[model samples]
Target chain A: MTDPRLTPLAASLPDTVPFVGPETQQRRMGREFTARLGANESVFGPSPRAIEAMQAAARDVWMYGDPEAHELRHAVAAHHGIAPEHIRVGEGIDGLLGLLVRLTVAQGDWVVTSEGGYPTFDYHVTGFGGRIEQVPYESDRVDTKGLIERAGWTGAKLVYIANPDNPMGGLQGARAIHEMIEALPQGALLVLDEAYAEFAPEAERPEIDPTDERVIRLRSFSKAHGLAGARVGYAIGPAPLIAAFDRVRNHFGLGRISQAGAHAALADRDHLAHVVSQVAAARARIAAIAHDNGLAPLPSSTNFVAIDCGGDGAFARRVMTGLGARGVFVRMPGVAPLDRCIRVTAGREADLDTFAAALPEALEEARAAP
Target chain B: MTDPRLTPLAASLPDTVPFVGPETQQRRMGREFTARLGANESVFGPSPRAIEAMQAAARDVWMYGDPEAHELRHAVAAHHGIAPEHIRVGEGIDGLLGLLVRLTVAQGDWVVTSEGGYPTFDYHVTGFGGRIEQVPYESDRVDTKGLIERAGWTGAKLVYIANPDNPMGGLQGARAIHEMIEALPQGALLVLDEAYAEFAPEAERPEIDPTDERVIRLRSFSKAHGLAGARVGYAIGPAPLIAAFDRVRNHFGLGRISQAGAHAALADRDHLAHVVSQVAAARARIAAIAHDNGLAPLPSSTNFVAIDCGGDGAFARRVMTGLGARGVFVRMPGVAPLDRCIRVTAGREADLDTFAAALPEALEEARAAP
Candidate 1:
């Protein structure tokens, strides 16, 4: 019997996830990793208050979460000193990206992004049948001017750039981003993914007007607030554009426990500051470990450091495989130049110690094999 | 500045939620309801073991939920005596329905369903630019033969029916549903939404093959499992259809806490049995209360009772408004025949007592009004 026919778009799309989570890797390996330093998850953990709120919310899981997410929206808006109409809460930045693409992209529409940028964004665009016009990174950072030019040139519907970019952990200044926003084509949107925003310097965060129609900024609790597993993310955009999300989003997508945790996490300013400082310290230690092993660590603004493994992509892949074999879960970029380095999350001392102990042996093995 | 252009399909869609949640009304009313029996949520609550599991999971919210939902999938599969490959977990049945529509329904693709069926399903179809061909219910029950005929006639890509259906709380025998499945047109998929399946008697449930390519069954922890707020739902289908969900779904949409709770809740068969029994008792009590108030309660196999107020749609709407005014939250169906009744959820003694006391006053007020 013939299988049910998929939509032409769905039929053409490969079954893929943006990232193969570290847990899947561990399960395949038949053991848990000694150091969980991949995926850029904050190992320091969520605020104690957020944990309490989640535990409390657990008892009330029988009730459906407020479809409108009213209280959480209000809290998030207040946190940014913007009206709630300017924000929309979703499962995570990943989910929001999918919605944004759905709202704007039609079949064969053009979308622009830096090559080796956020793969989830690319996944969303491709899933919606949007043609991606990729601009290569320059000097190991997302080339903002090149992206804007490409968007304008192709009349792209959306341009996605993760500020304090992932995989490489690089930051572009606010002024450069503002200029890119100004250069956006009339009908195009600049999807400013600020998943790592909290980790960057304040000045590096663009001071875009919340009501700016050309740009929508995404924020997440996954990094600094340490709730990656909760999957809470919100987008700040123009009121009309924000309202458009209601047309396509799953109204009850946010879990009740997640909403409660994010609400409490937003209220705990001290916890965020503490995590930021802890991440800073961890970055220094990770960089020190890289230097101790004679590897070059790239300067990073976010919670992870990408260490150059002193070889090609194949060599770096071997190093990553060795790390995985040694129970240290780390990742590398999928593309060239970026793939010469291994990315490690900023983790606690114990996690870093495991990584430090594993790295020398793993590198020696890779060198010997090559 | 010009707004970012929405795709033509997204532009034409209305900003609407399938159900205006009780919380949204409460925020507007500026007071909490005395009883929330509108949404069919189990006020009996989830298993204590599930709650404990969620509480523990909250501590590890820093990490991302397993994108594959491995343990949860395995547990769900084991519960149903199916291979794990046949199970695909999602944010909720609502979310899963959205993905199903995305997978099958392209622009202008035809989808068939009951006229007053699950509006969320319609919402997803329209959001994906699919045309809906709605068949009216037969005597307050989803018209199985009529839906299949329509699906066959229109060459619909998808057909939706919620067994132990919502809004009306009606049931159809397994033999009838099996006949409908046989009648489904080739290339058309039968979306069997068993969101309220656990509450239905075994005789009322259809015994379909788990690997049936012609049908996909949706199950939820929202009803009998009492974890609606956690947003866990799964689909049982042929392995190929189940695998397609990975292409479009938010990999981490289900939160870590939710996965843990659902896993624990699945194992707690005792909690589920207790809830089912409690729901049965509450349904009886609600029916008696309806009879005492000189209203007619329809025969129900699910968790809610639809009480006919011996009036037209307008009159029943007035009664619903009166209930709301009296701080008792309840909902009535949106269309005719069905709209002549107000749907009330099965609640605890105290909650039903509140409903019992408020019903007479609400009826009196509605009768007294113009």
Candidate 2:
């Protein structure tokens, strides 16, 4: 019998995940990680109110979620002081990025992003057969001028950048982002992934016009709000661009419980503030731990810090592997010089204690390895 | 500044939802749906065990859901006596269909389906720029032979059918489905959407080889499992086809609570049997109500009954609108002949009581309308 034929594009695409979850590693190792700091998920729990809301909503799981996600969208809009039309809630920033790529990047279309940026975005672009033009980071930060230049050169349809950037924990000021937006090539849309926006300094959080037609800003409840498992994220952009998502997105993608939790989480300003403060404290602790271990920790505007391992990518990989073998979960950037640093999420006291204990032994093993 | 440019295909598509959610209607009416029977959700509700599992998972929403969904996939595999490699879990059958279309149907590729089959499947195909070759339903059921013929004629890449079909609650026997699978055009993949599989007679549930390369059976927790809001669905197919999903899918699409709920729901066979019984009783009650109102109710193998209004599409539409006005939320097929019937989901006794009370008045108003 003839097998079902996959589209040539689908067939050509490699079967790989953007990032392997810690659970998979746990299963492989037959043990759980002592410090669950990998994947940059907030180890801090979601707001108590969000937890209550999700638990309550669980019993009402018979009905499909509101396809429009009306309440959450409105609440997010009110919080941002933007019209509801400016918002489009989706499964997560990942899901939304996939839809965004599908909407803009046709086969062989050019797209631009920083080298070793969010792998998921690159995965989506590649899955859709879009050619990615990667610009190297300048001093561990997203090279905004380089991205603009690449987009202009390639006539790229989409340009992606994460403020308080992933892997490197580098921050580009709001002024830099606004300048980048203004400098975007005509017809090129900037996909500003602000997944860590809530963790950034308020002043550094770009205050782009909600109605900006050239850029779409994505925010997630995953990092600071601590609801990554709920898969709630939203994009803010021009009404037309936001509405266009409705054409191709899974209308009922968000779960009812997720919507309720995110809505409640948004309303609980106190919990958010508390988590931010806790993260700040944990970040300081992590930096101190790195210093004590004779490593340099990068300044982070997000929940995770990138600690330079004072070695090359291979040495950092060995250290990461050693940490994993020693029951600590952490990750490093996929490409160098970013990969010269190992990324560690700011965890609670006990979690960080485990990380701190594991780091020295892992570093010793890495140095002794061939 | 120039607006973001949508791909030519995306720009060509019209902004439309496959189904207008009851929540949307509720908002416009300034009232909640008294009985949300429109979406074919199991109002009988999910298993208590599932609810408990979800509630417990709610607290752990800080971490992203297991990207591989290993545990849930294994449990589902064991339930069906199939290998875990055969299953690919996704957000919902709607989300899965979109991915399937993307994997197989490139631009302008032909896809065959019954004219008034699942509109969401058609929406996915259209979103991916596939040209649909819709065969008319044979009687009230999907025309399997016609679908095969159409696929052969058009060299369609995909052929879609919902077993124990939606919108018009019809079932094709297992033998027929097996034959249809055998007769599928060489390169065409049969998308057998068995969303209502548990509602169908056991003998009617096709026992296709799990390794069948020509067909992929899509199942859902949304219907009989009563977890529509959880958005968990799986596709069982050839291992290669299943693995290919990894190339383009949102790896962490399923929320943690949703996975827990669905896994628990699957383990509680007693709860599934109980829901099937309840749905059967509700279907009988719904059919009786249609008969009492002098309408013909089609034999239902699914959680809904499509009651023929003994009129054309326009008249049936009026009946549906009248029912809506009376706070009885229901839907109808979107094409001719099939559109002559209104579809009502099986709801709880109390909910069906409201439907029973409002049917006659709705019929009267529909008849009175110009």
Candidate 3:
């Protein structure tokens, strides 16, 4: 007989990766992608100051990172104008989301999110045995009222909404988000993922209180700070919930160099401002490229543009595959309606130039496909 | 009314940090520890090649790490003479332990471990709501037979054992470990944590097949490889179980820089060999220092020595506090009997010299304490 082995929940789970990285695809293709923009990672790169801090910390790999993430948390708290107790730094928002799921979702519990939203959050919900109730987006934006309605009906414990949502690069304004937060059912909590907050206009960003028990906001260095490879993110929430993270988190999960890099990245406001403007410029260029190719570009407040491929999901998939074949890496949404578009990250001039060159050929190949 | 909340299990858990890192202590003391020997981290540091690789990767932080960790996993698999499918790498052994506990230990499930073994493993067990049945250490080593007996009686889903264990530095031979594996109950899997495997004599390390379903062996670059700050560790086990990690692991948990550093560190075998020998020499020096101070140094196969203060747990704690006050960071076991000793990590000559100089004064103060 086989071993008594995994718990039933673990046994039921399929060995699935929510997303395949561009590197894996590159390996299988036996070639490097000339334009790398698949995963919504920052292409402007971390500040020179941040890179230098990481390099300086590289020789100190013997000691484990501070478990409390003291200095980094303090820096983040100061940046957000919150107490250090309000912040909990983690490996990344990906890691933090898993912990949040563990803390709230139990077996057979209900969690709510927009359809075709972040698959990583869904993976965590399922991994924790939580049932995910999907609400279809309203005009390409996460349907806030629909999400609240579903949560109330299903008694969902957690409701996830990514401001400047992935795949579509759509955003909801502060007033809409504030209403959503206030509308949450008594036992429900709003997980506001602000991973792209730095790229959004100030007026569009929410102004929720850090101590609001009804909400917890997650931010990442992976987006604007250009430190995705550094694996640093932080959650700002009520002290009680943030305190709970200590009971379950891999306390030493953040690397010492990552902590150092993050601290420096936070301090370099000029670099962040520069990256934001560059992302805006690149976004405009991407939209222009889409318009030139006879595709429609959705309005974006993020570092990426979602271009409607003017056909079915299959057409979009074909375009993405065509891009892959042409040495340009890009991604698209998985579900219907949203799948009519391909998402491209803001990249450097050279990287965008490569994408610009490859786009016409890729579109031609897609159009020529049976 | 309060927000819809964490699950009852999550709410019921206490906010606890298993180990308070020396960095936190240093911050509290408003000064850095002179020797920095508390965490059992290697003072010899990661290989020069690893530092170079990490520094090189700093500029490339925009990319998220490969979700599969292909190159690093392949390198580790090759080094161990196993197929890549047999290995799963994560943030560290701590992160992997959290994943393993999540996989096997559902609420109210039974798990077994030595009373004073790795606290991080115990933290994971409780975090997952597993009922931990601790078998006391026998004569300063993990009670292997006791653990097996407890597992059988409780129908434990998992049993944990650390070879060349932390805090105590006591080890069991390869034959004994193999026997323990064979004796595991039908419903139980042994989590053989070999975090210190590189430091032990080759004959003392077990020779279990990589395909063994009954056991999962964990190894860490954080230990002898001097990459603790990098947060890289891997598990070697049956392909089925190794595959299950995909369901719950933060797919992009490991940093791109960390993966690069780990690959370079693994390739530098000469650096690893040199660190191992240096750890051994440091262990000998620490033991000699303990003897000179009229304390008993437990024989060690790991990178740290456990010094018996020739008194009770309280006495040992005072000595540890005295050392801490003197800016010589060190740690002691949390439980009784075993707590009679203070754990000191092996450090470079200058670091140990700092410890050697601080020991006598600290001992005198501890001895004079009421």
Per-residue alpha-carbon lDDT of model 2 for B13-82, expressed as tens digits? 8777787889889899998878888889989899999999999999898999999999999999999999
TM-score of chain A of 3: 0.99
Where model 1 places Cα greater than 4 Å from the true spot, the runs are B1-4
lDDT of 1 by residue, A44-65 (tens): 9999999999999998888898
lDDT (0-100) at residue B118 of candidate 1?
Answer: 86
lDDT of each: 0.91, 0.91, 0.91
| C-alpha RMSD (angstroms) for model 3 | 1.3
Worst 10 residues of 2 chain A by lDDT: A1-10
Instruction: Give the per-residue lDDT of model 2 (tens digit) for A1-370.
Output: 2134888899888878798999999999999988898778878898999999999999899999999999999999999998999999999999999999999999999999999999999999999999999999888889999999999999999999998899788789989998998999998998999988888889778788987788999999988899999999999999998888878999888989999999999999999999999999999999999999899999999999999999999999999999999888999999988899999998999999889889999999999997
Q: What is the interface RMSD of each candidate, in Å?
A: 2.0, 2.3, 2.1
Minimum summed lDDT over a 10-residue window in model 1 chain A is located at A1-10
- In the range A1-370, model 3's lDDT, one tens digit per residue, is 2234778898888889799999999999999998998888998999999999999999898889898888999999999898998899998999999999989998899999999999999999999899999999888888999999999999998999999888788889999999998899988889999999999999888898988898999999999999999989999999888888887899889989999999999999999999999999999999999999999999998899999999999999999999999888999999999999999999999989988888899889989998
DockQ of all candidate complexes: 0.73, 0.69, 0.71
Q: Report residue A165 deviation for candidate 1 (angstroms).
A: 0.9
Model 2 per-residue lDDT at A156? 97
- Which residue pairs in candidate 3 collide? A187-B4, A188-B4
| Share of true Cα-Cα contacts across chains kept by each model | 0.86, 0.82, 0.84
